[model samples]
Target: MPTKSNNTGGRGGARAGAGRKKSAVKEKSENGNPGGRPLEVLDIPEMEGVEMPKPHDFLSAEQRDGSELQAADIYRETWEWLKRIGCSQKVSSQLLERYAMASARWIQCEEMTSKLGFLSKHPTTQKPIPSPFINIGINYMNQAVRLWNEIFQIVKENCNTEYSDEAPQNDVMERLLRARKGN
Candidate 1:
């Protein structure tokens, strides 16, 4: 008697309806959209009864003539300059705040420099001693100057202004002073 033949075609062979169905909806495509359609844009909701604070809000009317007010003015001017130079709002806002802080620090340094002279007399030795406060004020002023320079460079580059590390030959204020003196 012949033995019954028993052989499977192959391991994990394809069968009817074994893979994904052709009619099924694609959840996502290679371009990262579902059903081959882009996502919808939504409008931002309007805020009501919320007022934005002014830049100079930190200073009172009486204190508006101080360094804090000057800082706020610098911040506003820097913001406008950055915007005119086509900087993004986020970057402009950040840089404006930084510039304002630097200006304020510079003012503080000026005050410190005025109060603390370059040299101080020794408490009892009757000799001169270098004033540590002056050194600190100088450091702060240097940092502030550096920050201002960097910010100005960025603005110049963005606005495609003539790049020059040297000072201008005829200063406007100097020319005005000469005219006034001659007349």
Candidate 2:
């Protein structure tokens, strides 16, 4: 006679896991999803024909268009882009107006400076018509002034001479004169 194990209770239907085998060994529901709703194959909302990225995937660095642009650099670039687009007079006028009123106010300030006749009073403030633009990369331009300062500091620290001991200056009069004389 076979001995009846206390654990099985001599019945295999539920206790011995004959019918409860699946319950004992929990089947991970599709993706171990707790909710009844189906697990999403794609993270983003998929279109009729277009596919979406999976959960593990992400937008590439190139796909990301971030504001690496500085205010001054943007002012320069927008003007350049406007020029490249080669707008008609009506469109140009509209763009310039919109650009002044909305996107940037720098041009408006520049126009005012010229119109106010104070441009001559402040000779240093009067610059040439800002054209012949450079394609300065946004990433580089943001840190331009900061990098320039760092470079200047490096030069000041490293290029020590007798003049280095001289007092701080409003202008480099000596250097300016020498440069003018083609020294």
Candidate 3:
């Protein structure tokens, strides 16, 4: 059997596919296999001389077209979740804004991972893994989730107190009487 023809440096040029960028997965000749990578094709002028690009530059065109979601989206989504759980609008927005910086980081990281090549799926689950930029994104997401949970806990407790009227409070007269009696 003949080797395959060299592929052209089509869409995946300088930018890695951060979005759904399409690159020529393979090119072929009818006869036999042409060669190794782009540089190795032989005997065919049109098929030969094709150049392979750095794999890292996968998303340039994809980024240009279908960009990743902004960091604000995370806050928006999280706030939406809070609202569904009965948090007030003020509380929801506060939850989003509390970790604005963290949200930004999370967005970038998530985008990088999401936009990787289709074949670049994860080994364990056959899902895609994140790129280097995803480091910041993951960290940011974790921070926002932690902070959101913390604030939500506080709000939940407050709601319980206000609705149940179970918070401890000494009446003025009771305090005075108790003080006099040293009770």
Best by lDDT: 1
Give the alpha carbon lDDT tens digit for every residue of 1-183 in model 3. 865465763444555424532222222232233543443222322223333222122212234447543334334444444444433332534444555435444544554455562235567897766455556555766786676555544445333122222211112223234433534
Q: Which runs of model 3 end up more than 4 angstroms from their true locations? A: 1-73, 80-86, 89-95, 100-104, 114-131, 161-183
Worst 10 residues of 2 by lDDT: 52-61
Q: Highest TM-score: which candidate?
A: 1
Looking at candidate 1, the ten consecutive residues that score lowest on lDDT are 21-30
Model 1 shows how many backbone clashes?
0
Where is model 3 poorest over a 10-residue stretch in terms of lDDT?
A: 164-173
Model 2 over residues 1-183: C-alpha lDDT tens digits? 977767767555644313421211122243465555553332223234322112111111122235121223333343333233221111233232232222122222333344443323325766644321122222223333333333233333222122233221112234233433545
- TM-scores for every predicted model: 0.41, 0.15, 0.33
Provide the overall lDDT of each model, using Cα atoms, as 2-decimal numbers.
Answer: 0.47, 0.30, 0.42
Ranking by lDDT: 1, 3, 2
**Which residue segments of model 1 deviate by more than 4 Å?**
1-69, 84-90, 121-127, 160-183
Total residue pair clashes for candidate 2:
0
